[model samples]
Target: MSTIVALSTPPGSGALSVVRLSGTNALKILKRLTSTLDFTPRTATLTKLHHPDSNDLIDEVIVTFFEAPHSLTGEDVVEISCHGSPSVVRQVIDASRNLGATLAGPGEFSLRALSNGKMNLAQAEAIRDLIAARTETAAKQAARQATGELSKRLAEFKTRLLDVIVVLESAVEFVEDDLPPTQTNQIKEWLLFVLSGVGALAESYQSGHLLRDGIQVAITGKPNVGKSSLFNSLMERDRAIVTAVPGTTRDTLSETIDVGGIPVVLTDTAGLRQTTDDVESLGIERAYRALNEADVVLLVVDGSVNADWHEAGLNSFDHKTQVVVNKIDLVQYGHSDLPQGILVSAKTGEGLDDLRAAILGAFRGSAIQADGLLVTNARHHEHLQQAKIEIKEALVALDEHRSEEMILAPLHNALRYLGEITGETTTEAILSQIFATFCIGK
Candidate 1:
């Protein structure tokens, strides 16, 4: 691959911006930028960047060099930390391009690292997850995966799988007669061990998805029922406008908050009610859509007033909906009069904790792993499922007195599926899709 260049830091005005390049020509481009030859590996040098042809001074900067095989991409890497002025950064990058460094595409840096054996596919994806993590707990989880924890675990599975494969193949090729019952029983035990481990890992994907992507929650209620007020209270800030007037919120409002290390994407939709106005009607349409898609729905109702529960759509709400009775402060009395639900005063901040707890309880099966690993990517989960299926097939073939070829066929497929998770058997098209989600310059 040719030398690739891009702005490593977020673009625009800042104290400093970093421009990174990786390829065989990275050294040449750095030399052209600074006109200094002696760039010791892993050392930072203060330098002045100048235009290549015109020799016009561009900017004073700090340059760091990471020599080949020791860098992020396992190539000669150069990083220029210059003044954050857009003009200066532009000139520096333009000068490098003139010297033969083309711009990098999304995830090109880490993709190269994976190609050069610096990291496996799982570790490379982990780096991307780390960059995009939403919460501290999510970041810690990604950090652990980035350190090859998943790859290490997968490696152990592969080793044990290979052992089973070798024994099965030997019975197919060396032993002409049918295997004795003793050896067959022992193979079953080893197969069971691998099956149990893979099955457990596959089951952890639900927890991993929640930890990584979080859950979507929709807040829906009739207008003036304190839905917006409860949205602000839940967010701990006034993100949406609150007023006594009806139809103030004619559009869906959404925000994310950290709830016990879980990122909750809370969508505050327009009040669900009949309206003649076209705009409010559209908003109500969106409210229903939000409710349909949400992992959890908060059906807020005015506690101070009484109405038919069936009219509010609360009576027919699905199991995922939580009935929240807001405005208990207005009631200002015992819960005997209020309908059966979680009573809270958006004004007094009552029952909000229980609401949050209820939101978490919706996903009781996918609790966060305190200090364990999970298959965060859906691709990984699919591969594990496929491998599990094939493993089960292999066990069935062994049990049913099937041919050695039949038993080895599914076993080989199982190995390939496992290999795909770590990129040993992954294809080019799938790799493109995986790396395409990343931002340029890694």
Candidate 2:
């Protein structure tokens, strides 16, 4: 492969920027730029770099070298730390390109690492998850996966499956050499064990997806029901413009907050009320849209007056709807037959904790911590489900004492499906699509 180069650091100016190079000519190009051949592997050397053509000074940089077979890409790798100017970063890349290095495509470094056996397909995806994690819980899960937690779990599943497949294949080869019923029972039992494990992982996709991509929560109510106040109270800051006038907020405003390790995309929308003004009508229309998209809707009501459920923009309440009585300070929340819902004073921060708990309660299992190998990716889930179906088919054939060919075919398919998760059997097209989601320079 040709030597590849790219800016490792983000674009624009900062304290410092990193430029990475990999492949056979990486060290050779670095030597030409610095006009020195004495860069020690794994040691940083501060030197002045010059353009190879003009021999003019480009910039003074700190360079590090990693020899082939032990580097990130299992190839010769060189990194330059230069002043963080877009101009300087671009010039450094151009200087490397002038010496026979080509710019790397998106995720080439990590992809090369996978190609060289440094990490598997699952681990490569974990690196992306770690970079895009929005909450601490999500980050911790990604970190564990990147360190081979999921790979180890999947390896155990594959081992058990192969053992069953080996027994079934042997039975197929020795025609008329009838195996004992005990061995057949053992093989069937082992297949059941593998199927149970795969099913459990498939079931965990809901919590895994919630951790990777958070849920949306929309706060809605009639005019002047302290919806904006409740939003600010939940955020613990004056993010939205709060006013006593009805329809003060003319558009939907959104912000993200962490509640019990779950990322909540909280939206404060305009009041749900009839208005002749065009702008107010548009805002009301958006409020209903937000309501429809929200995973949980908080219906705020005035505690001092009789509640009007119709004006709250709902014919009936679903499981996602939670009633919140605001302005608890303005009226005595006495024990009466009036209805039971969470009462809060958004102006004075009363019952805010319960409100948060209510939101989390809506998503009962979404606040799960990354304890073990919870399958998060949709691709992984799909493969696990397919593998499970094949295992069931194999089990059914074994129970019926049918021809061994019927059982072995599904067993082979199950093993291949499991292998696809770790990239042992993944197609080139799927690999391209996966890596394309990654940013260039990895």
Top candidate (TM-score): 1
Model 2, range 1-442, lDDT digits (tens) per residue?
Answer: 9999999888999989999999999988998898677988999999988989999898899999999888888999999999999988998999899899999998899999999998899999999898888889888888888999888888888999889878878887898787698998888889989999889888888788777877799999888889999999999999999877888999999998888767889999998887899999999899899988999999888887777655665755466888888888888657353346788899899899999889878877654655666777889989999999999999899888888889889988988998888889999898998999987888
By summed lDDT, the worst window of 10 consecutive residues in model 2 runs over 332-341
| Model 1 whole-model lDDT (C-alpha atoms) | 0.88
State the local distance difference test value for candidate 2: 0.87
lDDT per residue as tens, model 1, 1-442: 7999999988889999999999999998888777788999999999999999999999999999999999999999999999999988888888899999999999989999999999999999999999988888888989999999988888888887888778778877776788889988887888888899889889988888887888999988888999999999998999999999998989889898988887899999898777799999999988888888898988888888876544667555577888789998888667798888788888889888988888898898776564578888888999999989999999999889898788889888988998998899999998999999999988
Clashing pairs in 2: none
Question: Which parts of model 1 are misplaced by more than 4 Å?
Answer: 314-317, 367-370
- Looking at model 2, residue 326 earns an lDDT score of 87
- Which candidate ranks first by lDDT, i.e. highest? 1
Root-mean-square deviation of Cα positions for candidate 2 versus the true structure, in angstroms? 2.4
